[model samples]
Target: MPSHRAASLLLALSPCLIAQTPASPAPLDGIWLGTLHTGGPSLRIQIHLHQDAAGKWTCSLDSLDQNGVGIPCTLSSATNPIAIDIPAVHAKWSGSLTANTLDGTFTQGADMPLTLERQSTMTKPTPPATPDAALPPADATTIRAILDKDLAAALSSGALAPSTNAGVTIGVLAHGKRTIFTYGTAKPDSVFEIGSISKTFTGLLLAQMVEQKSVQLNEPVRDLLPPGTVAKPASGSEITLLDLSDQHSGLPRMPDNFAPADTTNPYADYDSKLLYADIAHHGVSIAPGAPFGYSNLGVGLLGSALANRANLPYNDLLHQQITGPLNMTDTSVVLSPSMRSRLIQGHDAAHNSARPWDLDALAGAGGIRSTAADMLTYLEAQLHPNQLPATAASTPQGKTLPAAILASHTIHADVPPGMHIALNWFRADATGNFWHNGATGGYSSFALFNPDKDFAFIVLFNTTISDKSFADRLGQHIAQRLAGDPAVSLAN
Candidate 1:
């Protein structure tokens, strides 16, 4: 998913070594704070500047959301319109200084406006609390009505439009029965890229490997890699398979060396060779099991390492472990002829036709394409694993699919604001709802389920829009409506 929240890349900064300071204060020597207004959640950025007696300037950056601090940066120019570059992350900033403010644009993978204001003291951000509304259970008919009405309204308002080929497929599982709804050109079998939701599947694969005793949660990741592959942090902290699954491996969201030949089809050329080279070049920065920092690179490496251990390609391993047993024929990284035929043409924010992404070696991070029907079947298994036949094929070490599903749901870490992380699935501690969302260049998808209430909601969009919260907000509202809570107005 190329979301500002998870997909946006940020590099961990090594501590900067400051030189001797001059007695006199330098004109631009202070902490400058700013915000990067991503279309989704905003990210706070901190730039620290200092000058030595020799008239030399040094700077460092901190991304508070990513927990990246003290990252040394090159001061390319130090004048009214100062130029600064963070080579390690391929980001640059050029701003005109006026008194205590530096207004400029931050260019990384994308260009975003940034305005830094000198602050007398550093500011600490507080995570928002999750809503704790008690939802009473509603019947299937009620949920269907609410969702149908909302969808119709959204379409009329152009929220779900280009109106020509635009499509949306939604599936809901309530009281052990499944119901699917489609709008515009969507059908039950319409295929769309599920983006970062692929991480949750990768997480399940790791859980199955652990259950089969082929891998240990605490095992060092290097053991699964090719000989001499560097997988240790400079801080002497060993990154474990669990660390990667839980988003605490201290790896960046994307590799610094990533220079895609075609930005539209970004990951197509990134092979294992490049992936391994990236790991060797930029080892983990933060200690394993520190703060939660989402890393596409970390999960992608995990998938690669797991495939290496199994002596199979990533897609092959995925079929052998997950999609195969679940009978999710439409869910796969490499689309079959049937799948390609059912594939929907994705649109960008401008409602213009857009190219689909080929994640290549990083496929585990955001690759799989699936249909709403297939996703609902997968979610149904999660809700009731025992329903799987006992004769179902097990892993090499004889671990059953049911056991692996249960293990994947076990909470391993806490994401603040009353939420828990279970493998790659996020759970609301208050509502006990497990959910994950994904997005690529042209598509967006969201899946959420509550086992206690015996309900699940899945929505797929064949287009990406500026309103990043639309799919998620709609899913949450549907969950609320299922709980018999007052229907929250859908975002137009």
Candidate 2:
């Protein structure tokens, strides 16, 4: 789950247009408004098109409901059927343009109908206020009570249906104290897929390697690939480890060659063989180190490259480097028998049973699974890296775990609007808070912490609801409460 506010601008335009074309295409300049039928709530979408004196067109998008505004988008064409691409979210839209309306479908993972009517004048809404910087840390008891009440209501109302084994587990760390709360069937030790949060672990591994001088941030990723394997974009430079971690590697969100045998377990059969073949056959079109584009392929390739350099499997390297030293026994891509017993069944948005993802070659992207207890431990290390026990290994250059942790959290790139990227973690410019969210077919998780306030929050849910922002909103609201800020409703 990327920031709902940041990730909701999923509009893209394809080249396919309606057969009929206007004899003289109308100017696309000015504001256009529409409603996106996303299967649940209708989202109001606004698009701004500008034509420069040079006759070039530029575009931006706004998802009003999600508070995503001024999202830069690529204007693919200015012909009869207008085309636009939002590479950041791997989405596109292709519509036939008319005098006052643009009719098209928004395509990301699915196609949804959208119609934009030209607006003569439009006004922008004020953005939400940032969390105050000077508020005191929130009280744990109050936070727990609010969360308990909200979770109970959600379950009782069938909002979290197929609830037989469904529940949520929350962990908070404030002022050096730790607290764990469970609602419904979730327990402190219940196992759930942490999804993209695994990227943070992979990022830490990259930092460790960099700290040890095993690799340079600017080193070309191809250098570490197996012999005879080639990974290069059609133009520009080769992708680097830093570029991959920061999501600037220009790789698409996913490989076009990916055709899963089992839609239920999409990544299960996608092994290294297919991954390599795709890279060689269909190299990236954009240059490396380009503007931010979320690329699971890029990070997955990075994990494979690093493993090749170390002469170890990705999971083995992960354990030896991060989880093993941290003693996060419950965290790993390959679960042990003990972990399997505690693994909760995942559910789709509709509350139907969903299979867990395997993520074979792409384990670096979103594969690891763990319990709330383990995640809190991981977060604790991040908060107070210097306090980690002496048992944790240090880099060969004598760089300690604390140094690597700080390196991973160092801001490296911008993620539009006001968000910044620190390795796989997202940093809020206003609050200096670091956070990341993860979602798989059946689960969603959120982690947020502010070092200045010495506070952290982690939320894990057993199902993926229609509203993707549920977990993230819950975590942020708790953080706000802990900071002594005004209490906000946790209703979805």
**Per-residue lDDT of model 1, residues 216-281, tens digit only:** 998888889998878555466688898889876767667768888887777899999999999888
TM-score of each: 0.77, 0.82
Q: Positional deviation of 155 in candidate 2, in angstroms?
A: 4.1
How far off is residue 188 in model 1, in Å? Answer: 1.6
Where does candidate 1 clash, by residue pair?
A: 13-71, 136-483
Clashes of 2: 6
Worst 10 residues of 1 by lDDT: 1-10
Off by over 4 Å in 2: 1-40, 47-61, 65-136, 139-142, 150-152, 158-165, 231-236, 282-289, 393-399
Q: RMSD to the native, candidate 2?
A: 4.8
Query: What lDDT does candidate 1 reach at residue 434?
Result: 89
State the TM-score for model 2: 0.82
